[model samples]
Target: MGSLDELIRDLRRFDRRKEVTNALARKVREPVPPVRKKIRKRAIEVLPSSGGFGRWVSKLSITAAVKLQGRAAGIKLKGRRKGFPDKQPKVDLRRIDQGRAAAPSWGRRGEGDWHFQTVTPGFFTETTAEADEWRKAAVSAVDEALGVIRRG
Candidate 1:
């Protein structure tokens, strides 16, 4: 019934301008925590810790957020090379992830100067595969958030 300009102005005042955006942001961000936890657990199963520093799995981190611009959301998993700072760690992450023997190292408390056994490659790919469901959840969350915005 209103003019296009009036419709736009009203929409800006009580709806899409902020309420929709905030609701959508919360919705989109909801799946990230569970996904992050699943990823951390999978990392431990896929990556071995027995003969290595056992720290890389613990170092796994996830960062996720919906941008305030109301345009985007993202999830990032972070981890470090075993010998971050470029020194020699008991076993390098890249080497273990690739199913290769660690070059050489002597810092492990009781296992002086040892070669770590090759871990099966694809650990990187498989560990995060469990989170594929997260993408689906995120998509549905957008719909839920839009519905909430409309109801308001």
Candidate 2:
């Protein structure tokens, strides 16, 4: 059996593992990437002026009143409508079951859709360069945390 002091130190290290893991998780989550690029500004039109005076208006009926109320007439402006990805995949660290960290792809697989790839381009796999980078970062983080715990 280990000494009481050694056991206490081990317990302290175990307790701190969650904090270190969570810190690493936050780091992993923040840079995963946004779901999609912002829609093109050209698709929508914005006017600096709220539509200056209309060509025809009766003198008795106030045009200024109409402006104050809202638009003089309902101008139906429509653009090309389409579906876009809305949810950004997250880095979920499951401690209870598998005890592994993962950032799910969220079922975004398309040959032509580039935006979906931004969120999760399969960086978790061993075959990719990104995976190697992730491994280095994760290892570095855990080592740094262990060093802190040892020093403390």
lDDT of 2 by residue, 74-122 (tens): 1111112212255323222111012232222444434333231112122
Clashes of 1: 0
* TM-score of every prediction relative to native: 0.48, 0.27
* Candidate 1 structure quality by residue, lDDT tens digits, 1-152: 22223323344546455665566556556676776666556556665666543335545545445443223423333334444344455344455556764534555533355466656565544555657765665556555554554466
What is the Cα-based lDDT of residue 25 in candidate 2?
Answer: 48
Highest lDDT, which number?
1
Q: Runs in model 1 with CA error above 4 Å?
A: 1-15, 51-55, 67-127, 145-152
The lDDT of each candidate is 0.51, 0.28
TM-score of structure candidate 2: 0.27
